[model samples]
Target: MPLMHQLWLLVPWAVFALAAGVKFWRLTRPFRRQLAEPSTEQVRASLERRWRADQRELTE
Candidate 1:
């Protein structure tokens, strides 16, 4: 086979990978923004709230 044929086979795979990466980045972009610089107090409060909610659900 020629070099061009080998290179052409990789084009579809490259396109698929690029599309997947963009989709994943867009989907998680907001979450990443919020977590990029979270404060310790904020993190603790969020975790505590979630834990309390879980405990309540378990008791029900």
Candidate 2:
């Protein structure tokens, strides 16, 4: 009922909102980048390069 109690209750919701926003941004980033690119071939090449870089990083 007090202002402090109300603010305390909102802490969890605020944390959840921030986490969800970050997750949504990360999930959409690849699709958004692909859409902005001019050609499918370019997109494919870029994704392949990224995959290779990930593989190399893992091997190291």
Candidate 3:
């Protein structure tokens, strides 16, 4: 509840959000544009899913 404690909590949370945002930024843009229609949607979805899954596997 103190100002210092609030600052400490907010600092790390802001850092984490910024980091995650930077990482995922523009990740799905190309895919989304190319796959907005029906046929390519499944393929794009698979690619996107695999990408995130691979990142998780690597991190783990």
Candidate 4:
């Protein structure tokens, strides 16, 4: 693999790590939200997409 190609693998992990960090940080905060989660469909679709992509990475 090329040098840049190897870096591609690192990028996603970095992004996920950042996202998790942010989420966990949010959980520790005391902000009250006036909004509800959009919908089950949207949530499911996002999770499905994330799962599929992760699966493809592992399989490849």
- Give the Å shift of residue 36 in candidate 2: 0.7
* lDDT per residue (tens digit) for residues 1-60 in model 4: 999999999999999999999998798665434255558898899999999999999999
- Model 1: weakest 10-residue lDDT segment is 34-43
TM-score of each: 0.58, 0.58, 0.40, 0.46
Best by lDDT: 1
| Consecutive 10-residue window with the lowest summed lDDT within model 4 | 29-38
Over 3-44, each residue of candidate 1 has an lDDT whose tens digit, in order, gives: 999999999999999999999999999999977978999889
lDDT of 1: 0.97
Q: lDDT, candidate 3, residue 49?
A: 100
Ranking, TM-score, top scorer first: 2, 1, 4, 3
Candidate 2 lDDT, tens digit per residue, 2-55?
999999999999999999999999999999987784787987998999999999
Enumerate residue pairs that collide in model 1: none
The residue-by-residue lDDT of candidate 3 on 1-60, one tens digit each, is 899887898888899999889777678678878767667788799899999999999999
Query: What TM-score does candidate 2 get on C-alpha atoms?
Result: 0.58
Clash count of each predicted structure: 0, 0, 0, 0
Over 4 Å off in model 1, which ranges?
38-60
